[model samples]
Target: MEDENNLAVLICGAGAAGLTLAIDLARRGVPFRLIEKMDSPFPGSRGKGMQPRTQEVFEDLGIIDRVVAAGGTYPRMREYQSDGTHTEKDIAERDDPTPAEPYHIALMIPQFLTEELMRERLAELGHRVEFGYELVGFEQDEQSVTSRLIGPAGEEFVQSRYLIGADGGRSFVRGALGVNFPGKTLGVRAMVADAALTGLDREVWHQFNNGNMERMLSICPLAGTDLFQIQAVIPLEGEVDLSDEGIMGMIRERCARHDVKVQSVTWASAYSMNARLADRYRIGRVLLVGDAAHIHPPTGGQGLNTSVQDAYNLGWKLAAVLGGAPDHLLDSYESERRPVAEAMLGLAAGLLDAAKRGEMRRGRELRQLDIGYTESPLTLNRPGRWGPLLAGDRAPDAPLRGAAGSFRRLFDLFTGSHWTLVGFEAERNITSGRKGLHIHRVGPGCELQDMAGHFRNAYGLTPGEWVLVRPDGYVAAMVTPDETSILQMFFSEVGLTDADGLRH
Candidate 1:
């Protein structure tokens, strides 16, 4: 609630996407306010598994350790038959190397914990969510966007330079902008639950079919609380009461060795899955991110991850342009992220189809592909099919040593609100501090080093390799031994011009 004339990015919905967007912008020193229609938190665990890419995003947001500490590593993601037959080969290795701190396995954590951790980060940045303030409508000019907000007291109008509809699938903002979320809906509804159980079989995730019924089961180990989240999928079409007893019995019948008693239940719910994608994610001064932009079946557990990553892709550019970097800088938000969304939609459809056909092996393996931005203007010298030359989506999380402390990490330098010029084992120089770039020298003698961390080789550097990391944690530019496009592309493409355009 600052000056009405002074507006930044006004976001709708404070869920995973909305909050992550808020936190990213805040960390970028951008002013933004997030609003949610509901006044209270959604009870029960929502999204469960955290993808590898998402865990990397959390690391950039400085919350991965918290999430990892809260979420015990499953070490393996398995797909099994109802009769307990392993289908897909277990995936345990990180693929597609990136300079980004963690090119590791996907971490599974409760969506609630992810949301809470993001909110805590936002709090640390002095931005609080305006809960219950629903977005009724919004109108945008070239310079600013006016949003109508409704809450308990009544109606309030908010104005911002840009408006992001991070709201759920039924996005009012998308509708206001006349975007079409065209896709097919599943006739087969799935019942998902997060309940306590005394299980007969122990596995991280179990997926298979019993006769005509197909189901997916996941046992995510949550930290702090000895409680575990028992997620089971029940096919729709039958008159099944979604009560605690019914869910427990379904799980018992599915897993128990007969005559097994049901233990206490924690939470349960049922919902149908739909695969949909917005025709366009950007229009004028308004844009869509997260579920507002696209949605798909929860098979890969990618809904939250996709949206949060969308924000990560957007947050910095929007913050930069709004904070007076360049207006065209914001346009790249669409150019870079939209295609990624399309790819995700395509991948999700494939997974859903595999699940529908009981092709669990195909689904898991396809989902395991950590395909980064292979096709986008953001990637450097990227051949249409291969991927970005300097790891477009994946940033190198090299073992960086800093002067502060032994625990310092690579993202630590970029997380703050400035473009970082990191010259490994070399001195860095800025023309002047007023130019809005931060330079830090990282060397072996520096104190920061992972004691037990796994990213020793991926980002573990030796003597001399120069890289320029953007505030968003993507490699803005890099100069490796063999590859060399460090100076010109970065300075010319990503760096700002005096004319106020993102010089690509």
Candidate 2:
């Protein structure tokens, strides 16, 4: 009951997480097929918040404008304390004077809108979502993976060198691989609803009313319609069931005191959050992403943001490896992202447990905390201040100008091929030697003013800050304006060659 075809990658699921990975890889010309079990995308504004970091990633994918058109900006946050109202610190605005990477505030976009934009963009690259195709079974060998999918078209078997399971929390891929998603599913329950109401200041979040626990409410504004991500604790005594009337009664009572009424309700769900991370990202030829890799409480508002970042980190690595980089390059995906996931999971647990114990104020301590890892193997040469960059770690963004064109970032143009080299030295300073590296000159096609402006104003590129950007956009290595260390980095990571092989 199945047809078969050999594809490069057969990605499972088509939600925001799945679609994001697919679009990034497809754009790089890596052949892949996306499979979804549902007849269509999951309904409801399920996760209705986008952190600023995600807004930047959305920009890289070329869909931030559409996401903006679909959702409004984040409403002002109101922080509270027992003594009095405390002024919330502006964490979004990083005071550091860096011209590159401009997004400092989170964008509020609906989950469905995010997925649709990514899907449409992927279509622009000529890949369509394979809807209703569910993965019923899969088998992997030393060379490849074979998956069985069932849908409206019946059964089809897919063959590929690698597989990704972007399927959600109850992921079939995780189950199939026998990987342990070990962690704690705590007994903290809350009710979230999407509904229409009036008389409430819909834009700003309202927290702690008249010193009553039952009166607490959190409301988020979405873009396209009169939709809000409304949340309140479940009020029933003795191990509560998050039933409809129980949830609605809590909402009605909180709103009633304020003279606000919910005239219509769209959707509601109740679940106690679980904090967990997978023991591994790759089980031979299959890898896990998003909720499939890790799950956490929604306290920090990091769930969607972390998953999308995971896909971005993995997408380019997969493209480069499939395009013929060493398989060891793929190993760094788990090494880089897993620790970040581990950090987030621990952070989520801390915030969630702190809230339940009613030690409410300490939850904000994360903003002022100076976190570092003397222990993370992925940490680069400068470990304390540069936890985000390590061996095989993602390079921070910088504005690169060249004859090829003026780009808002170094990551933008490098998305096309394996490696991008930016240097302040003349073309004569560039070199091709024994190891194997690709070098493109930075002059001729583009203007010097625009290029110089991007470097001086956008990135703090001194004569010595000549940066070496990898194919995947991580800073391979940094040195003073010496062509020796810079070109050596390219040769060590990428080969110095054309189609004819290694250049002299």
Candidate 3:
């Protein structure tokens, strides 16, 4: 007999994607169960780079302080050539933080540390990941999904309104759905590990290559830790010895440096590069996120960041749908994120090829700040509205001065699970009470003043214009004072009524 337990959402896998969705739903008071097959948290330094856009997501999730505190900036690269000459240079171009974009550079934090930080935040929100619980099988109907999960206790059946597959690249959820994951293997293989080593400066990423990219070995110091991540290319056909002693021998043989010695390895794994994307993101009431939906090469450091953002985008829609919004809201998840995954797959593959040719240079594209959903179905654009930032672009942060002389940021106003409306020189009548919406007015005689012109400079708002930001920090719509009816219709379509805010 199947034990009956019903939930709003059943999240499979406890990695970045799963934890992110869990945290989001927990904060929204949406009932969810996050389950993972592993008995403990991940302990590897893979996916160590956090992009700037992901930092913005973390800020809104209220964990940016902890994430920033636990991470450090990327270090310069020191390349040793075959002629015994070495040179040091930056791995990527660094940018100065501005009022609109505070996190202008990628942060260096191990994937394990990032997951631990998010798990802590999730616990504080009164929820915890159910470890050792594996999703064995599942079936979906029009109303709900019945999932068979096996834990330490035994098998139990769970009924949930929806099921999300945030499992890794080889996701069982995706496999059960039989969704076509189509892509080619890039024929690149390497051994990656975290080890304590001496005779290396932690200030730079050490690369020892004898004028051959295929024979290169890199030892990068993991930020905020005493360990170094060692990566060495291995033959594609041969079996790699993943033991600590073997990894140490490989490093020693490749570098040929008598001074450097590996003390011990905390974790080690063999990695093969592949660029694949799921043919479909959703099948009925079940959906996929992160590596389950798309897998990328580690060249560009986009996988984890993209995965986290996938959960960020899907969380609000799931909450809204469960709260009585149109079920079609769920469809927007695939439409918005799949194309991004496709693009990122291409980018990562290109970077991998560039690295093979010894021509790789991390740039702004890897920072992921330019990602947006301007072409998404949910984005509303007024024909004559003119600005660099449009509907579906990320809402920029700016300094604000309150009427009582208190300083704040636009992000501060957008810190919760509610839509935000920023009206510039807009009529006061439009700012009237709206359910699940926060209104802020700027311009003459308004409560908040853009003292430094940061808001105006970032948004380029004309007088009497307004920007409606979605729960995920993207602009849902941009309108003029004359387009009030359009705004009302949008709210109505999104299940927000004048009488009931979000209909919870």
Candidate 4:
């Protein structure tokens, strides 16, 4: 039996990224310890936007219903001019959900509430975060990572196969590893607060600005709650007060409306925007994820969403390695995610510039549905066999009909921690009774029937074609009936075989 105290992974930080990885590992039966330095959960309403891709991840994690119930769509932007004139416009162009993309709009829920929901789900999986445990330092070897923790009970030493730093931008783990985070601070300070206020409409996002970044103020209603999130840009030089009275004063001066009053401020903070990415993602057995690996401005609402996806991409790979896969499999996490972080950093910086110019135009890119791994080492694409979707692209969802005439969807089949091989009108039986692999056939007389032709239309598939999807919902490989051997070869390259299964 495995030692209960010895963990497969030791995760530091209890933010969305850390909690996400913990939940994934817990459901997979991977032993892990999630620790947070703070004594309690975060109380701020920062990072409140959930992109479409993140919504899809929430569905697989089994919290989509609750998340959707607790969230609301981005409201119309109500801008207040200096002459007391106001205009209303949509914050982002809304898209309806189709048969292919089930979630087409961004959902708005405060960060604290999202974390609370995830914590509840983690408890259901028989695990809970270890709060007030601070990771002071650690060292790694070829076999294991030994970490030192400072908690209420004093100091303790623990060992795990790997250590992941989901800690924020000033990450202690990254500093200990001496990683270089090269970027510039934008030299603009912004104050953000969550408070209960009177006299402000709750249906739209209220903005008071004079076409200057340093003179912008926004009060937006927080969905599923009785409060508003207030944000204001402070001057570059000088100290800005964060008290309730100071915040109210700033709001009154900017909007020229004394009727709006802040009753109370629950949480507040002042922060300077910066864009940075770690030069490397891993060193030996210690790795970085989320804000520890990259930090950027909050202009595009991509910070939290991107961090959550980072953890999602790394969770399965870490579990695979701990279950006796090659260590090189862990290397692919950085190779795949680092470039994405870099690209998103550039995008967020560009959006910040746009926001300063009062041109906050949000498009499909902000939804993050187009991110993929077409250039990863793990992806395999057969030459001259490309369709609308290719290897390393996100697998689109489609409606299906079950053998018993029950309604089904592709996401329902890809919900668990298993590899899915979907054969579309294939001749031979590709069903493998492997422990961690699931095979489904979609055709006229198969177990799953695409009677509406949604699958064929979404995947652009002809007869005798098969698509293998990875655990994280990306197309791993595409093959024809004659190229069935490619599936076995692909599995072998990823360190999985039929004899050993995916995990021992």
Candidate 5:
């Protein structure tokens, strides 16, 4: 039996990335303690855009409804011109939801609200974020990670099977681990603050730019709240004053809108452009994630989104390995996510450069819908596949009919923390025997009927073809019924025996 005091995983930092991983692990019944160096939850809207991919992740985590209810869409941009006239433009082209991609547009919610929803969901799963616990130091061996933590009470030593540094860019754990964060600073400094203001239309994102691009200021209303987030570029050698008066004065000077009063400032910080990636994500039993692993410009709103994706990708692998899956299964986290981060870093840096030159544009690339892991070692694909969807592609959503005329969706079936086996025309007797597996058959008079044939076309599946959807919603293996051994081989390679199943 495992000791209750010794957690399976100890997560540092209770931000979006840390909370997400905690929620996923809790749902899987994995023992973990999520800690934050701060005494209370962050109370600002630092990273406010939730991409389509992240919405799907939230759906699987069972917090989609709460997120939708709490967040709103990105508002139109109203640029304040030099002639005292405003020009309105859409932030991005709006795309309606389709059968394949249910969430076609991004959602805008304050980062604090997003974390609150996740924390609520985590509490429902019987876990709480331990506040005021700071990880001062740690040492890890082949078997476990012993962490030195300082808290309100005092310094205490704790042990865990694994340690993850989800702390922000100034990660003590990452620094202690000696991982090299290699990248250059773009030398652009900016000041951001969340404040309650007046004399601005809350329906649009108000932008004020000086002539010849000498200065720029944007006051974006935080969705579903009475506050606005102030963002503006400062001089490379400019002084930064993070006090409330300083923030208000800076806004007044930059926007030149004396009518727009900064009534109150809640949170303020100065940040410089630093596009960097840790040379390695993992060193022995300690791992780095979120800002600790990668940091880039927030131009494309990819920093938080990418960080959340990292947690989503790593959560299941951690659960699997703790449950007895092969140790190498954990290695795929770095192999798959590093490339995505690398791409995002370049994309964000380029977008930042473009914005500086007044050539910024929003497109499908920022949505992150097309990111995949087709090149990962765990992805099994056949040559000459007859479909656009492949082994490593994201499993799309489709409508389905359950028994007794019950209606459901493909994402509803993939909502839990378990590997799902979906068969088109295969026998259930062969696929349903596995423990902790949810098997669904899609055919006439079957457990699940493709109500509109969306699944068939979306997956490009023949009658006898089936696919293995990993717990994280990636296609692990796709094969015909005659090649069912491929599933067994893949599972065996990952050591997915009874020992590797979920604890509960």
Candidate 6:
């Protein structure tokens, strides 16, 4: 028998993906244990670019203020020539914020600091990561999973209703489950380290590349910190060193400037370019996420962002299912996230190839704003006509005037861990009618008023049109208000019931 308030989920890794999932679960009152094999948090600057979509997610997680305070926009790249001259160019075109797209640019925050903020939020929700604890083994039946964990205490056992593996590319959980991770190694190896440097401008990302593209090195200044992240390509066949001398040696050999010196190395690692996708995201009561489910090159900065998204997509589904939703709801996790991983892998690979050819150009392609679930089984589009945004697309944010003469944004309504229903030009009582649904009727006397027509232009909705935004911010169903039964059917299909405990 399942206890009413005991641990229900076991997360195998305590990285960004695992931490994001844990925070969401904590907000939903889902009991879970987050375990990390490492003795402490990751202390590197890997995956430093927080894309716009991920920033939006950070906002919903209530860490936006901290993130924005701890990060800064990407700096311009200054390329050094073989003749000791340098040419400066913007890394990417800058975009001003719009009413619909609030986070218009990528923010640079070190991966470790990002994880720190997330852990802080999780702690406020009354849980902490069990560091130095390793998942030694686990087994599952139809009901629960029995896991063996080893730490300073020697051995401990836990029984959870589900097991999630977010344990990087070489996941022990995936290996034990015998899931096939299929892909090719790009035969390119790279080394990265965080260190303090001298004779380098902190205002720009410094790079050096030969005409033949045989070598490339970049030292980018990390935001909200004094350390710079050093990155360089290495021979695929040789054993590359990760010491301070090795990194400084590469910089001296590749760069035309001889005055630059590495003062100290904080953390370092050498990684080969391997692109792989798991054959399945789910098997029995076990599931995969983050680098465990898919691993790829970090050229596009999609790896970490995609991992956090996987957690976001899974968190609410897990909560709903545990709260009495259907088992099929859990299936949607794989259906929605696996394809996203596949696509992201391909995109990252393409970007890696471009960087290899010395043709890397940063643009909106890596932003991930266009990622959607148009093909998801959980999506329902029953409108007689389409709109600027589709049913499966991300719901855009727009400013609104509240009935109490106050102002708010659509994202303000979407800031919590709950599903939201928006009725355009509908009755005022529609917002107050639902309890858990968190309905917002956008019209006169309602909380959301489109005074500037921003919402109208963004959603392309007519009067009485209804849109059901999922807890994860994807549009689930869209239909006319009169077609309430269709909306009811869509909810039932997606394993959600109305506030009255009825379909409609």
Single out the weakest 10-residue window by summed lDDT for candidate 5: 495-504
Q: Per-residue CA lDDT of candidate 6, range 332-393, in tens?
A: 89999998889888888887888877777778877888889988888877646676988789
- Give the residue spans of candidate 5 off by over 4 A: 1-5, 210-213, 427-429, 498-504
lDDT head-to-head 1 vs 3, winner = 3
Q: Name the weakest run of 10 consecutive residues (lDDT summed) in model 2.
A: 365-374
Ranking by lDDT: 3, 4, 5, 6, 1, 2
Query: Under the 3 Å rule for N, CA and C atoms, how many clashes does model 2 have?
Result: 10
lDDT of 3 at 448: 90
**How high is the lDDT of residue 321 in model 5?**
84
lDDT of 2 by residue, 1-504 (tens): 112354778889887778888888777777788888888876567666676557656767778888888877655555445464634433233333244545544566777777887888988978889888889999999878988888786886789888999998889999999889999976666667777766566646555442333455666555677866677665444554335455456655655444555666677777777888999999888999998999988776667777887887788778756755567766777887788778888887887776665444323223212222223332224333332333343444556564545455555545443555555443443444332234433334423323545444433344433445554445564334444654454453333454555333
- Cα-based TM-score, every candidate: 0.80, 0.81, 0.97, 0.97, 0.96, 0.96
lDDT of 4 by residue, 95-195 (tens): 78998899999999999999999999999999898899999999889999999999989998889999999999999999999999999998778889999
After TM-score superposition, what is the CA distance of residue 246 in candidate 1 from its true location, in Å? 2.6
Model 2, CA-based lDDT: 0.64
- Two-way lDDT contest, 2 vs 4, winner: 4
Residues 1-504 of candidate 3: C-alpha lDDT, one tens digit per residue = 112454899999999999999999999988889999999999999989999999999998989889888989889899998777899888888889999888898899999999999999999999999999999999989999999999999998899999999999999999999999999988888888999989898989998882365788999999989999998888988788877678777877887787888889999999888999999999989999999999998988999999999999999999888888899988999999999999899999988888887778889888778888998988889776777798988899999999899999999999999999999876674745776788889877998998979998899888888889999999898787778877887786676656545332
Q: What is the lDDT of residue 41 in candidate 4?
A: 98
* Candidate 2: RMSD to truth: 5.1
In terms of lDDT, the poorest run of 10 residues in model 6 is 427-436
Q: What 10-residue stretch in candidate 4 is worst by lDDT?
A: 495-504
